[model samples]
Target chain A: MSAALFLIALSAVLALGLGVYAGRGREMGLEQWSVGSRGFGAVLVFLLLAGEIYTTFTFLGASGFSYGLGAPAYYILAYGTLAYVISYFILPPVWSYAKKHSLVSQPDFFAAKFDSPALGVLVALVDIVALIPYLVLQFTGLGIIVQIAGYGAISKDVAIIIGALVVTAYVIVSGIRGSALTAIVKDGLIIVVVVFMGIYLPVHYYGGIGAMFATLDHAKPGFLAFPASGQSVSWFVSTVLLTCLGFFMWPHSFAACFSAKNRSVFRKNAILLPIYQLVLLFVFFVGFAAVLQVPGLKGAATNMALLKISVAAFPPWMVGIIGATGVLTALVPGSLIMMSASTLFARNLVGFVRPHASNAQTVMVAKFTVPVVALVAVYFTIQGSSTIVALLLMGYNFVTQLFPALVASLMKRNPVSKQGAFAGIFVGVGTVVFLTLTHQTIGTLIPGLPEMIRDLNVGIIALGLNLIVMVAVSAMTPKTAMLPAE
Target chain B: MKNIRLLAILPFIGMLAGPILHNGVEPYILGMPFILGWVVVWILITSAVMAVIYKYDPANAEGDEP
Candidate 1:
């Protein structure tokens, strides 16, 4: 076998081996399969959370955006750090409530907190819709890595199929623990590979990082700074603020919070995660390095910068290692996200419909739904969309609409009734879809707005409208018995 | 401790303000580009500030068991 094939096979075996090994002597109970039975310490929880947040987007998309769009890419680093700071306050409360009520999913948190099965069902449906495109993006990313690394020996479609099967199988057998174990390997490799390319490419091409930026400064002018055109400062601000709020709104992220042993786990993570975010800076270095060396990669081709640089600089074997790292970056997070969506469907939606369902039955439904979700994602991936980062942003936009309702649910007097919450979500998600479909930029729906307002991210706009509707509707509706006395 | 809940907004301000206030390429600090250096500094400061707030926040009282 060629070195690429051999290394790819080695990565496959390593992922599968670690995945299966994690399931040893453990029962496939719903709790164990979903949240690791709430037994994870700080280190394991930290890795799992980091692995979930840092996906193909971190490994490929951030660099691609930096190489292509310039200053807008900084939002990736800004959001991660801000999100962790937000988590220091938000996650512990949610975790405390989740632990108190045995909530295993994001929808479950909403349902129990607000005392509305209907609201829970709505949250579940919206989450699944937002997440399917995200899953498809992962599959597409894996296909890119495998196809590029295969060098025409293996087809992209077959590689994607094999990749999907590996993730689904390990998730079925080992559950979240499999994702966590593989995450350990995935993260270790990612750090080494990214750090190596980060340092190597810059020094080899442009003397050093400072020299790379200095060269880009002279060659490309404002490319090293925020653009004075198109994406304004407000866009950067709103994107960071909205993403920080929406970070934990993803079902899998909320579910991961429950896996921590205590609130202190989250507190500890908040402090160190910013330091972990330093990894993205290294990824940024690679993008800057590529800007001068590998110029003229247009559109979707820009996503190939890191890989192109690695392939050009390293031997086939080393390139294989980088390629495998990229594949695992997609696989580990893909499994966790698939599992989270399935849990939302099985526990939140199905259990709502079938209140008499047993834990065993719920576990079966969850396990069964995992592959089906993957299949849907695979179907979309085969069709292929070049909007991987856009899909992720859309996901965040719709999910962050839940922030007001979530805050209300945790309040002493949640004035927002279930009716208000449901209406707000529909409006929020609807607005996101409408704006995205129409190709309308943020703060521009009204037309003739100043560039500052027009430059804000659409998610923040949708969220603003959603919050308004929530407050207005709640004020008009009479409180049900479920509403606490104020 | 009384106003520690307000600390959450600081990271937002720190992160978003970089592009608005200092979107220049000059004055590179510690070998990083200007905006990149600004972000890294805020990230470290955010961590330190959060750690300080975590120590003082009453929600994290050692005896408070969930």
Candidate 2:
């Protein structure tokens, strides 16, 4: 076997071992398994949240985005920093509520807060639908990472199967704790590898970062900045705002807050996480470096720009290290996604249906659901054909529909009736599905609009419609008394 | 406390100002594209702003625990 494949296999084994070991000696109750018994300190919570944030998406998609689309990729950095800023205010209340009620999943928070199990089921459905695509994106990134870095000895399908199995195994055994442990190693390796490649490539190729930008700008004028039409400035601003609202709406991220020891853990992380987001600048640098050095990577293949450039620039052993890092990137977040989805499926969807299932029974259902979810994601990764960025955007459009209802329920009076929350999510998600399937955008839906208005993200339209319907429906319905969170 | 919490809005303005103020590529700030540099600066400013809010927000007071 080549050194690259050997290193990847070794790291996969290490990840599996560490993951299984994390659950050792602890009773794996439903809460213990899903939220680390709600006892994580600031550092672990930080790593867990950061682990979800810097997934294969950050490792590959960010660079590939900058490599393919230029200035549009800057939205990745902008949205995340804003998301952290929003998190500072929102997460404390969420943490306290979840702690007060021992909420294990994102839907649990919604169901309990709205006093409606049907709304929980609605949120669960949206969560699963949105999360599967995101999980598939991670598996696809793993497939690409291994196929390229392993010198093409393994096919993409085989790599995905192997990755899915390893993630499923650890997640079933260790749950969220396992993901958190592996996240420490994953973050450390990714920081070193991304920073080294980001700086080294620019300096090596064109003498320095400044000189590299100068060369690229002269060679391809207007390529590094957003144009006036598609992917324009309006698109960037709207996308950043939409994703900021939707960031914590992600089920794993929402549930991850339930794992923190105190409300202060979130406050501290909000201060620190944006600094962590700055590391993505190196990811963009790597992408920019690839644009000049190893050009001609178009479409979905642009996701390979980071790995391709690294393979060309470094030797086998070095590429092996990078490949290992990529594997951890996919596994850490993939496991968390799987964990969250299964818990949501079992605790909210199934438990709602049965209504009398014991806690241990629910945990069993979650454990069994993990491999099933993994299999579904693996099948989609093999069959699906969109770029990683496209896949993530599709998921975001669906998931962001939950934002309005979530924020409304957090208010002191909880103005939105349960029926209103249901209608809002239904209409919002329906709009996303309709627009996505019809291949329509703001430009096509309404003609004669200016370039700026036309360029706004379609998700913003869904969110706007969602708010209007929610308010309208709530105004017509009898007010539901707000439940005391304490 | 409410006024102090409003400090978080600064990041939203700083970042979303990209299109209006920092859309060009003429003046590369520290070897990066102009918009990219604008974002990097705001990221730092966001951190500093959040740190200030964290210091004074009454939610973090010693007796604030529920």
Candidate 3:
């Protein structure tokens, strides 16, 4: 590598290391590790949330979906931006409530709301399961960027291992604050690179965005039309719902939410998050244009679509900067996932499995668990060749099964049974796994429903079924088995 | 519980209407090529629903107690 390239990598590492050191001690105690000491300001929350939204998939999958799936790929564009306004109001109270209760994970809310540690533990396990593959997705993203950038002396596995190790060290040291500070740089670089590429590539290859679309439309009919290819109207309906409700269920989202310094900060960031997702529109063009320029790369992390473009087009030095940016993007999220997992584990799992554990001990347990989870993710991403879309959906679906009891407590007379929550999650996960295994395109799962409904996203169906079964089983139970829904 | 019911049904009408009235209309907001009008509308309506929830919140007094 050139001196310029080496210097960029060193600075990136140093910037991240400096960030962790700065966050070495926070007076809010465990809240800092789990949720940035619950003091992340408005701008910090916006950047942190944006970092979460724009993961390895935004770069790789959005492009892949556009290149491979056509206009229907716009779901990635629509869902993210919409999440801001939806969450703006929902999150403020949730954050206030979390702070009031000092809640560390989503399951903690469920446990307290429903008055069942068993339910909390079950929810914890579900989040951990969802997070593992999601972490692998990030690691896989890191590997692809490293391999493509030509780390000649360092093999692909070594690059991946090194990246994961660095991320784990920082996360274990400083937690969410570390990730959020780094996000400041990550989002800045991503914006510059995305805008530069979106402008450069379209003009460079096709005359412009108009010409690029025209070529894609001719070559791929119905490219701009709704329900293009295999994405059905039912699928669209289900996906919109899935994104709206389930986006809140992600465990890491709680980590981000709880980090807010105040309720108003949450609302401000929520209203503004759409603008960040709006940036995805530019990144989407990178993918759509790829169809016109270099269309054959499939089975890749959709987030990689951007990095792949950079590596394939720019010279080595520029490619290295973009590569470093991509690594940071993957790194931030990868670390957060493990940190959130460890937080969930110590709070819910150990608290149930070992009731005698103290707060300091729990915090210690969380710090140690980060590298273990990162290694597991690294192992899976390297050994596996599965589709990135499937990897994400599986996590989404599994976590979503917990929605019924969550929403139920907000209203209705139903009491939730621990057995019923378990059944709902297990069945929901199974249904998603079965559907994904038989996926038509990695875009959606949920087979065997009529074509109108089959690709309607398995996660939606899982949530739907989870609610029905939860209500039904709860109805059959005695009052003692139920939580007071109202 | 009635609040949850209202929350479920309220946005649903707009949601159904949205896909029917605006499907395939690419980023067209009142005839402008906004490249993301669906999302823009999505955020607007979602915020509106939350506003409704807030307006009628039963625990408003309790929340303000602190």
In order, the Cα lDDT scores of the candidates are 0.84, 0.89, 0.68
Error of 1 at B48 (Å): 0.6
TM-score of each: 0.96, 0.98, 0.86
**Model 1 clashing-pair count:** 0
TM-score of chain A of each: 0.97, 0.99, 0.90
lDDT of 3 by residue, A380-474 (tens): 87786666457777788777676666655554444766556656766777777777777634344433545655556656666767777776776
Candidate 1 on A5-96: residue-level lDDT in tens?
A: 67886897888888889998998788899999988888889998999656987788888888887767887888889889878867888888
Window of ten residues with lowest summed lDDT in model 3 chain A: A477-486
- Predicted complexes: DockQ each: 0.70, 0.75, 0.22
Q: For residue A200, what is the lDDT in candidate 2?
A: 98
Docking class of 2: medium
Q: Give the 10-residue window scoring lowest on summed lDDT in candidate 1 chain A.
A: A477-486
The best candidate in terms of lDDT: 2
Give DockQ: model 1: 0.70
lDDT of 2 by residue, A1-486 (tens): 999999999999999999989989899999999999998988899999988668888889999999998899999999999999888878988888988988999889889988899999999999998899899989999999899999999999999999999999999888889888999999999999989999999999988989988898898888789987899999999989998889989999999889988888888888899999788999999999999889999998899999999999999989999999999999988988998999999999999999999999999999999999999999889986764345567778878898888888878888999989999999999998888878789999999999989999988889999999999999999766778756
